[model samples]
Target: MEVKLHDIGEGMTEGDIISYLVKEGDRVSVDQPLVEVQTEKMVAELTSPANGTVKEILIDVGKTITVGTTILTIASEQGADPAPAKEETAATVAPAAPSQKSMIMERPKGAPLSNRVKAAPYTRKVAREHDVDITLVEGTGRAGRITVEDVLRYVEERDNGKTKAAAAPEKTPSVEKEPVHQPEEEFDTIPFKGRRKQIAMKMSQSLFTIPHVCHYEEIDMTELLDFRKELKAMDENISVAAFFIKALAIALKEYPVFNAKLDEENEVIRLEKSVHMGIAADAEEGLIVPVVRDADKKSLRAIHQEMKELTQKAKENKLTVKEITGSTFTISNVGPMGSIGATPIINYPETGLMAFHKTKKMPVVNEHDEIVIRSMMNVTMTFDHRVADGGTAIAFTNRFKSLIENPKKLMLELV
Candidate 1:
């Protein structure tokens, strides 16, 4: 039987073979990962269709091939195995078939006694680690909910041997035999594809291939906040986040080393002139980093317009291939998520990434020794230590700090 490579979606015409999880002649089971393919935007794994001996892998790494192309051949005994199922093309999953009016959606079975426990994903993961029947753990959350913390506490108790059965002095005999049941929560599982897959591959590569160093700086954004307020009053659509990107662009101009790319093949660093900045936007589907070309040369309005258009297009799933490619530096701002700080992974080929975190109102003393409530944001930059030094990263951050603290300086730079 031949296994054809089907498009998994995200507008990819072809995929570059990343690596094969299985080899020719290896017996594989259904749902087993067979190979990983890298599209320009992300990576995706193709799984085996049936239990069969691999006959051949027609595709090789770094080779780009079109969709519906036959990439592998497998040998299966007739009537011995069911035909492995293939996923429908990268388009949306076909909607569920209409059920008869009399049909009832039967929930999946869980804990022995009750059919109504709901747990979060993290909580379920924690329960599995502790070997605890989640359905049996009494939920303290609203409407009988199980939180991640609840599961963690249960694990800690078990680790401490604090169970009544373990610490009790009197032994009791079992009276009646009954099945122990736990309630299971309903969850929608999303497959990793497109940008999610690219993030994973780039993270793995950065961890293994590059020696990375992260430096942290807490920026006093009191001035920046005031500037943002003024800007918002003037034009509400221009986000403070876009201003942050402008700051980063100016910073790159001064610290060119931080903007350079690591040539892994040549073991050298190459500094380029054009500053293409990647703004990481969280869309309903996944994380997309759309680049702003020549950001330093463009006016604040142009940058804001481009960022807005790119983000909107990204959300609408209408970004062209050209819009998402060729970024020199990347910024992932999770401030909207309320994260205080994070050391983000460097997007490969590019040596640095800056993660902007939530701003908080904190008490601070100025040089005048006066206590004041000020807005503070933490900016963390992760760089490939092989190419850039601590001084380079710090300088880049300092320039960013200056631009953000004084937004008017950006207009001057633009002219």
Candidate 2:
């Protein structure tokens, strides 16, 4: 049986082979990962079609292959004598001689296979990159397949061991060394591919095509902070950003223009009925946004949980195409990284992007004219000026600020 590249997702016509998980002569169970491929949107692992020994790998690492192309060949018979590892690379392997009583099992189309590890291809790559043996890492994914999180846990434990070893007293005395400097600067050039390339293209298009205008505001988050504390006391694992997302979603109802895509080609604004909030997450590969669908309908706890899962998937490079697309509005939060503020570029097509900065304690005059310390956070809204005027953007931010300051309004219906 041959394992050909299948349609991984919509609009995915081709993918570059990042690496091969199984080499020729290696025995692979049905649905076990065979190769890792990098598509335009994400990196995914192709799996074996049947339980067999890999007879030949037709694609090489870094080679881009079209959909339906034969990726590898397998001798599908169970309990057959395993072939020895081949030293020479070949494009094709000769088929085994015909036998009247061949015990090869035929897999039915679209039928679920049992005893297969369920994991994405990128998860396997993470294990390989961290030098963690995935077989030893227990999976938290569907079934018993190892996940990137499992591999990360193993690496963290292994690193802690190394740290403890380094902390032990050394027998030899430490020697002081003189500093050395190179006269010429040197750097390695990595080719722009996969996520990096997609980011560059989209950013360029958004910047050049959209006429952007930014509105900056600061919010007194003392109440929201107190609210979050109360929620935390109840053992709810919610984030301040979740409240912000909820506030933004509610505010978007009043300002539908913000939660819209500008179709410049058609000269019209398409308002999204359901709020799909894209959360900007910085991953190892690059920056990616995984959207939370129907964000307006979800509670703060639900939003936080979804964001946590999506962010984890993003970091592990396990985000599917649907997870990364169809966002009506986006929030880029740099507060965790201690950024004071940033003027984020609009995510393409979406009319606006909300940027959140670090929250800090600052003295401010209250309504009673008394100076008091409070938690303050900066927010910047970057929007398409053509789709929304400056006044409208400011109005949207004001409504969002009111919701944040009030805290309870976020849970109330817009009406």
Candidate 3:
């Protein structure tokens, strides 16, 4: 049975082979972890498909390969035979201690990789550090590729080429010279390929594809704050962002256009009934959005609890693919993080994203025309102008504001 890298989720096109948990000639059970693969979003373990003994290890570690690429082959326990191995050449070596199989390094569709590189850059760097010729070293890694370990071993053997040099005369010791000092590097380089790269690509595509128009609104949070204070006195401490999500869900029901996807290929604006709210979270890896599935159906308390758990998981890089996908709309509660205002990029394919800024005590003209100190917050609604007009966004913001300003109104809309 050929074990290929299958699509896990989120339509991931490629993945990096982080490491192999099993080597050739090792017996593996069904669903046993065989390799740890890192996708664009998260790290996942690809398990064995059948009860089999691994026959051939194909790809090398740290290489990002496309989906459907045959990574390895297995000899199933149901009397299946291993595939024919390539005839070993002078450069070939066993994949494992007990296996006669050798590794084959190639890209998808059986296209051979270039033969120019004997070793990777880091491998050659190791040989250079020891003043060893990399071209003279033998390769033991996949497809006769030299690895760091191979270079180190060669250096050791070369240095210990017999304690006695067969009666060769010892040379006189030269005077010790002062060691030269080199200035330390003043810069550090961070890898830009994983989550950070994903964010950049996603944002760029969203920004360039959709014509974004940002709408701003000032909301009176005085009533909501007083209501929350009363709840706090009764020890009912719910997150303010949870309330925002609940109110946004209610608003989405009335104006469902914002909760939609613009499929240009079909030339239709698809409106979603279920409000899967994506909560923008800052994780150690990068920005991640964990979805609250069916926010419209969930109660405020349940939404709050799930949102809290998902945020924690996202921060710890433990979120599953389902928890991070299928968002109909997104929300960034930057209030706690002290953001004044921001035109957030729409979570692409989704028509819109709402950002809640800091709530502060500001003087405002009230309904009675008296300047009063009220807790006010600014909300920025970023949407695809092609899908919805500014007037529609303003109306949507006003509807959301009315619900949040009057907590009782928001409670009445709860299912």
**lDDT tens per residue, model 2, 135-224:** 556667434556555666768878777433466677887788897886987889998667675566467557756888889999999998
Total clashes in model 2, counting residue pairs 3 or more apart in sequence or in different chains = 1
Off by over 4 Å in 1: 1-195, 235-237
Residue-wise lDDT of candidate 3 within 1-415, one digit each (tens)? 8888888866455677889999999999999999988776677888888998999888899786667777888899997765755545546743443332223332343233334555655456557767877766667865677766677777777787822244357898999999999998899899766667557656755765689999999899999989989989998888888899999999999999999998776999899979999999988878889999999999878988999899889878888989989999999999998989998999887999999999999989888999999999999999999999999999999999999999988888888
lDDT of 1 by residue, 1-415 (tens): 7776675643334556778898887988888888887664545678888777888777776565556667787777453434455534324445545572223245334333344466554356557756888976767754556755576566677778776556668868978879888899899997554456445544654565568899999888877677767877887556777788777877888888878897756877899798899888887656678889988788777888898899888788677657887789998889889999877878766889999898999999989999999988988999989888998788888888877877677667764
Superposed model 2: Cα runs more than 4 Å off: 1-15, 21-35, 46-59, 64-185
Structural similarity to truth (TM-score) of each candidate: 0.57, 0.64, 0.74
Q: Identify the superior model by TM-score, candidate 1 or candidate 2.
A: 2
Worst 10 residues of 2 by lDDT: 84-93
The order by descending lDDT is 3, 2, 1
Best by lDDT: 3
Candidate 3's error at 288, in angstroms? 1.0
